[model samples]
Structure formats: structure tokens, C-alpha cells
Target: MVGQLRTHGELRTDTVTRAFATVPREAFAPGAPLEQVYNRDDVVITKRDENGLAVSSVSAPRIQAIMLEQADIRPGMRVLEIGSGGYNAALIAELVGPEGEVTTVDIDPFVVDRATQYLAEAGYPQVRVLLVDAEGGVPEHAPFDRIIVTAGAWDIPPAWTEQLAEDGVLVVPLRLRGLTRSIALVRERGHLVSCGYELCGFVPIQGAGANAERLVLLQSEDIALRVDGDQIVDADGLRNALTLPRVARQSGVEVGGFEPFDDLDLFLATALDAFGLLVAKPAAIEAGLVERSTRMGAKTALEGGSFAYRASQATSEDRTSFEFVVYGHGPDADRIANEYVELIREWDRLHRHGPGARIEVFPTATPHAEIPDGRLIEKRHTRVLISWPHLTSS
Candidate 1:
């Protein structure tokens, strides 16, 4: 894997390249499927139920490369890995070398045991594997030079920020409402700064750091009104539009022969920016109908009559703009589409470009605490409300 990474110019120097080539990936996988053991693509299927929902897996090679580069691992650097996957720990160990230390922790005991064995078999027993909740992070090893979370975290836990060594780098799949991004945060002068790295996907982190899944099942009699920032329509207007027919359902548009889920999320984010609202539902879950997943992005149900809505938007893999196929017996779909178009026009009027805006995240436990007074931003799915006064122009 490291050899291939070097071929792509991922390894900057011969010393790093040699270390990667010497580390055999097969040693870590141990009797895994042949296709997965050697396949350079993202093929590690860590968790699969009888129904085949992939709960966890090692991320792809390119993603690992991107993260490693962002991590900036150096010799004699102490590294702590959240969600103990042996492959990632081994890579970190290899990068940090013998003088440095690598400790990996996982929430699942079985995963930790397996990873420990795998590391021993691969001659990397030096990498410590622990069975503990990683969201809280392994504070016992305080002041780590670098910390990486293999699983996604809904927020930058104060524990993580507090434990982070000054001038340390923390990399994790950060969940923002409906989507998750591989965030690279560096602690400088007690401030965690984001590099706005590429938007990527990862399974949501479970346990303490996991967020509430916002897709609510509606009751039979209720209704939801959907709106985005690109349009000015409010919840009431959406209720009126629910009387119309669906406008575009499952219309497939491919970009470079690949479904553009990012593009769709961007579109949705745009709507959230102008309208400041998203799908809304009645209090009851049984009233709504299950909406099917799109070929590219979100799958929503029109259960009951309403879904949540957001007033402002930020583009993310989870919050991109895409047309949804609503399943309620109302005009909600038409209403949302019309409002979306209006929001787009307003964006043009205000000279808000369809692309490029940095999303800054600050996580807090209380709803009232840390509320930005200048400009409001909303994460539609989680009903998370925030504001970035500084990001208004972009």
C-alpha cells in the first residue's frame, strides 16, 4: 500500500518510501478476503449485518493518504488513534518509527482484541491497543503530539480539545448534522483552526459522541413543510404548496459518469442559506411516509405531513443540494422546489456564488451557549442552529 502511495508521489522522501515498502499490508489483514487484502481501493468491509448495512470499515487508501499527509506525523511523535483499527495504527506506527509511541483505542472490545492480535502477528505489538470509548479520547496519555479518530465524531468534544497538546494536530471524520467531513484541526494558542480540507464521507461515530439521527418518522395526520435559504418561502407557504404534484422525481444527472452526491449536498446547502428553513414534521412519527433514497444523495420520507427546515446553509457531503422524492399525499414536494428556485434567484441578487464558503464549527452542550449573534446557520437534520458572522460575505 505504501509503495503504491509513493508511486503517486505521496511519499516525499526515500526514507519514508522505504519504510512504507517494508511494511506489508497483508501482515495486518491476516486471512482476509483476497480481493480486500490486495485491492488498493476502499474494500475493507469491517462490519456487515445479515441485511448488509456496512456499519464500519477501514477507510480507503487515498483517504488514509490524505489524512496522513494532513496529520504530519514525525519521528518521535506520540500518536493516539481513536477507533482502534490495526491498519491505521500500524501505518501511524510505521510513520512515527520506533522512537515514537502509538496507542489505539476502540469502543468495541472484539475489535480491540482482533486489532491487538493483528498487530502482534504483523510484528507491531509495540502499538498499544486498548478497549475504551474513544470519543472521550485516551486522556490517560495526555498531551499527545497527534490524535486521529478513525470513526466520525459529531462534535469536537471539549475532552478532545482539552487533551490536545498545544500545537498538536487532530484529524477525524466530523459529523455536521446530515453529513460528515474529514476535518483537520490544529490547535494553536488554544484555538482549534480548520484547514477546510476536502469533503469526504464516513460512517457516523456511535456512542457518546454520536449525534441524534434527524430523519423522523411522522404520524399519519401530521404534515411537514420544506424550505431552503436560496428561497424566501416560509413554513406556511410550504404547507400550501404541499397540495401540488411532485416536480422532479429520480431524474438522473451524472457528472463525469459518476453520481455527484457532493453537488446535490451543495445545492441543498444553498437552499438552507437563503430560506433558513428545511423540512418540518409534526410531533408524531407514525404520520409520515418513508421517502426513498435518491440515486445520488438523500433519501427522505414524506411521512405524516412535515419535515424540518433550515434558514441558512453550508455545503457539506451530508447537506448538499439535491432533489428529494417525497412520499406524502400532499404538495410539499412542489412547494419545496418552487421555494428553492426563488432562493437561488435571491442568492444571485445578493451576489452569493453557488460555490465556495468555509463552514466553521464550534460544538457546545447547551443550546443557548455559544450562539453566534451576527449570522445564523442551521443544520437541517439535527436542528442544530449556529451563526458565523464572519462567513456572511463568502
Candidate 2:
């Protein structure tokens, strides 16, 4: 697992690699198979809600390693972990060494109790486990050198910044639009600026900071649009539009089979005026109702009675190369489809291989003139700005 993480560039530093090699992951996930516990990509679900949704779990090792690298933790630095699962806290304890302090907080008492027991049993009794809504952070342990959030956050809470040391780094998997990215941010004046970000997903945080996306169901429980922010969605109109014929347009952009295009998704989420994620089940794709683009939904643009989403089709016999395509439905299908295709072409031309988007977070009360020029996503607590940096030709 350590070698795989190192090879994938997730575990970059020796300190992180040592922590991964030293910690006993199986100790935290008792009763699970050793093979499963050691799997780098699998998450050990420890608790679930009445709805059977995962409420807590030991996060996947890959994500853990990626976030740890992003954190750049050093010995003697005080670290506060937002979500507790014993294993990650133990890893952080190891990274920080005996001179540092590690505190793990969770909203659920059951999680806190289990994590406390596991930490004591796993030889990490020194790590502090607290029961509290992390939205407010652990005020008693303020001025932390590193604040690592282990859950998906919709907005940056003021307490997080207020408690963060002036030179500290806050690593969080922040939700922008409907896409989630684990960003490493540092305090810049009164706001946070990104040092780097990675594509990731986590169970949403529970409690005062919790914010759930509004799901607009189109076809019963099979198809839905996951809308974020204050973007109003017309469910009835979108449902009726989906039944109409789809207008398909192909953008000459071709991507190799193993290539990743998450950056393109981020671009579309920012470039389009109104955006949401188009989620569909396998049944919907197999029934020929929607194209087989993404299992977790495709990036979609919503405009009144019209909607368009990203789709792709194989352009080679070997199926190793595929061209980017857009599918539109509604009264303005042709117009939306053309607009979506043009954005894809624009991304490929200027930003595909260049520096990706620059994301910044400012307080909600910040004036529009004070915010940077870009796509601004307003939340209850903060306004997120995403701008693409210009690249220089070598």
C-alpha cells in the first residue's frame, strides 16, 4: 500500500510514508478482513445512519495520504483533525511525533467514544478525542498549526480561519458548485488562498456546518440533478424536457482511455452560467435514455427550460480514444448544446495543459469589488472565486 501510494504521487514525503508504514490500519477497523483493511483505495465504513448512508468511516488510504501530503505537517506542530476515525488520528500522531499535540473532533458521540477506545487500544492514548460539532472547531485547542478536515465542506466557516495560526495550512475537501476538491489553503490577509488541490470525495460533514445539495428528481429515483448554491431548479420543467428528443453535438476534443478529465469538469462548472451535476443510474443509461458518460453524473448546465450535459463517444476502433460530446434537451436544446461544445473547445485550446483554476475563499460580507474576477459561488458563510491562471509559452 505504501509503495502504491508513493508510485501514484500521493505519499510524497518520507514523514508521511513512515507514518503509513508504521500505523496499524487493521487495529482501527476491527473484524474487517486484513486484505480489505490494507486496501489503499477502499474506505472502511464504520457507522451508518438510519437511511443506510455512511455517517462515518476510516477514509481511503489514498485520500488520507494525499491530504497528509497537502498538509505538510512537521514535528511539534499542533494539528486539529475535524473528523475522527482513530486511524487517521494515529497517523497524524505519528507524523507530529511526541513533541506535538493531536486532537480529533466529531459531532457524533458514538464516533467519539469508538475513536477514543480504538486510540487507547492501538497505543495512541495521547491523542485527544473530543465530542463536538467541528463547525465551531475545538475552541479550547485554538491556534493550531495545521487544521485538516476529513469531511466534505460546502463553505469555509469563520471559526476555522479565526483558529488557524497566521502561518498555518488548512487542508479541506471543499465543495464548489457540485464538484469536490481537497484544497490546501493558507491564510492570505483575511481570506484563504489555495496552494494546491486534488480531486476527492468524502461523506458530508454533519452538524452546524452541514449543507446538503438539493436533488431534483427527473425520473423517479433513477435520474436526478444535484444542484448546489442558491441556483433555483425547476424540477417539473426539467423532467418534461428530458422526455423530448436530445440534441447531440460533438466537440473535436479527443481524450485517451486512461486520461483524466476532472479539470475539464471544473472548467465547465465555472464557465457555464448555471451549473449542476447530472446523475443517472445504470438502468437509465442501459435503457438508452441517457448517454454512458459518468456513473456519478455529468457536469450539466441549467437554463430555464433547457439543459445540457457532457457526454462522450468512442472515435477509435480500439476504444482507446474518445471525442467530447454534449447532449441537450428542451426548448433551447440546439443553443445550449452549441454553447457546451464551444466551452469544451475553449478548454482544450487554452487551458487543457496549462495551469488549472485558482480558487480563493473570502467572507460572505466581502464586497463584489474586493473579490477577484472569476466565477463567484456565494454560500451562507463565504464567497468562492475560481479563476484560471494564464500560462506562458516556453
Candidate 3:
């Protein structure tokens, strides 16, 4: 079954494909609605509480595959699955086989109970389900071959690193700026080195290891963007733009098969440059609202206005399109859109499609710091790290 399933999915091997098929997703999702249990789509929200918010869920199959591949798991491996819900642990167990050991942990005791019962009922009782704060990890089962975080973490906690075995791999969804990226970190010579990056979104990692949410306030309009920092610069121009009257708004636009995905860092850097003027000055930050359009486009609303503009173009078009229902002349439309257009073209100058692309996260604390002469990297307030060369390299 796994072999056959592999032919249809993005996975490379029949082994993983089989594991997915054999693991009846329904068993682990006991309380989940039928549609979600059988749906092979994206993540299925399973546990939402009184406040009407999602607290836990079964990750999408595609995401599961991506993480598993990034983990580069091997048979007979000792693995640790954080924020366990039984479904992912069950999949890992199937891949690891009887010879391998899988320790699954969750902060909620009830979640652990459910995972244990589900795994036992499924006849894979060998999988250990522990009720503990996974943020600190299950140190008793230290030195895991691979540690997979099912939730999102704003920063890599030191404890997880300390528990990692030499050469171990840790797959986590790291939140950078406001975007989440799936990161694979390998323990190399006592250091956690980046193995790879993938575009992703996941629930925030809870517990003592959680990071404080960064909040951004848009002065005039109701749009507030929360990243992990207060160092938002150049928002003045945007703030001033907010004083304009609203005339029109477009829903959104679409962009696909673009080079940005190939190199997210370059895409972000270009975005920062193109939008830097707005991000740098106080006027811009207070002026408007910015929201993600399709993977390649963005929707922005002028200040004191409710109208929106969708920026996108045909897949084959040489020049991208900025589609908008202008409000009251949208006097600044051409200048703003042209600024974005120029930034997108700069992708070629930096070669944003591959390797040289890098995304750097800055901590919310101090605005500036000194780097040691011989060190290439400097840790930032446990939540961020900035490379020495990056400051002057640009």
C-alpha cells in the first residue's frame, strides 16, 4: 500500500508511502469529524477550546512528508516527537520499525493519554507516550537520533540543543519576522547547523519555552502586524498615506511558479528593500495595511481607507501586474506599485532562486550589538541570532 501511495504523492520512497497508508489516520483522530479524519489535505484542526481557537491538530500530509524527508530518518533510529497527538508519532513509529524507539511527548496530560490509548489500540504500544512539557523535552530519553517538533517555535531553545545527540537532526517550524519557515537543524560538532528550509505555518509552541508575540500597531487604520520585534523602521510614510480617503478595494491577485519560492531569503530581502521605504520611516508604518496576496502578491489598504489593491500578473507576463480599485485617485498608486516592481526585478541581480539566499532573524531586544572579531555568528537574546558579516556584508 505504501509503495502504491508513493506513486501518487510527492514522497520519494515506498517505505514512507506505505507507512502513511497503514497508519489509518482515523484511529489517532478519534474525536475528529469524519471529513477531517479521512481528508488527505492540509492540517486538520482537532482540538479547539472554549475561546473558539485551535489548540492542536493533525498536520497536513504534505507537511508531514516534508518534515520526514528533512529529518532523513533511518531504521533503528531513536526518535523524539514533540507536541504529540499520536497521529504523527504513529507515522514515525511505522517508519522507524520495531528496532527503533519513538518517544512522544505533549504538555497536556489528556493529549498524552489520547496518544497512548490510540497507539496501544492501534497495536503499536511500543511507542512511548509521555505527559510532559515537550518544550523542555523528555531529557530522560536524551540523545535522540531525531527530534521533530510538531508545533511552531519562535526560537530554538537551548535545552533542545543540549538534549540532541551528536549528529542528531531537529525539524521545527521556526517563526522569522512574521513568516514561518520549516527548518531542519543538525547537531554538528556541538553546534546546531541549518540543514534546510521550507515554507510552512504551524501552531505556536506553548509552555515555558514559548516566545513573546511581537505586536505592531498601525496608527490610523485597523491593520496591525505582529512579528517578533519592535524595531520596525520606516513606517512614517505609510502612516501619512493613511490620512487619504478610501475609494475602492480589490480582493486579491495570484502569482505562481515564481523564483521567490526557490529562494525565500532573496524574496524576503527584496521585499524588505522594495518595501523598505515604508518599513523605515514612521509615516509609512502608520499609513496603511499590508496583507499577503497569493504566494507572490500582496494586498494593501491606504490609511483612513478600507479599500484594497491586489498586486499580481499573468503567469506568462514579463512584467508583474498590480491590480487595484483605486480610491480617490489613489494619487500615490503608481509610485508605490512601481517601487514594488523595481524590487521584484532586483531578484535577478542577487540571484534569489537558490543557495546564496539567507533569512536572518533579529531579536526584539537591543537595536544594535558588537560582534566578536573572530566569530561569524552572534546569539541574540536567546530568541534571535545575527551573523557578523550580515551587518556589514550588505
The lDDT for every candidate, in the order shown, is 0.56, 0.92, 0.59
lDDT of 2 by residue, 106-136 (tens): 9999999999999999999999999989878
Q: Please estimate how well model 2 matches the true structure, expressed as its whole-model Cα lDDT.
A: 0.92
C-alpha lDDT (0 to 100) for residue 353 of candidate 3: 35
lDDT by residue (tens digit), candidate 3, 252-356? 332354334434232533244221111213334244433233223232323221223333334445555343222221346555444434434444344433353
TM-score of 1: 0.67
Best by lDDT: 2
Identify the runs in model 3 with alpha carbons over 4 angstroms from their true place: 1-9, 31-35, 215-222, 232-240, 245-266, 269-310, 315-340, 356-394
TM-score of each predicted structure versus truth: 0.67, 0.98, 0.72
- Model 3 vs. true fold: TM: 0.72
Give the per-residue lDDT digits (tens) of candidate 1, residues 8-84: 65555654555556666666666677666655565576776567876567766656766777788899999998876
User: Worst 10-residue stretch by lDDT in candidate 2?
Assistant: 288-297
lDDT of 1 at 377: 43
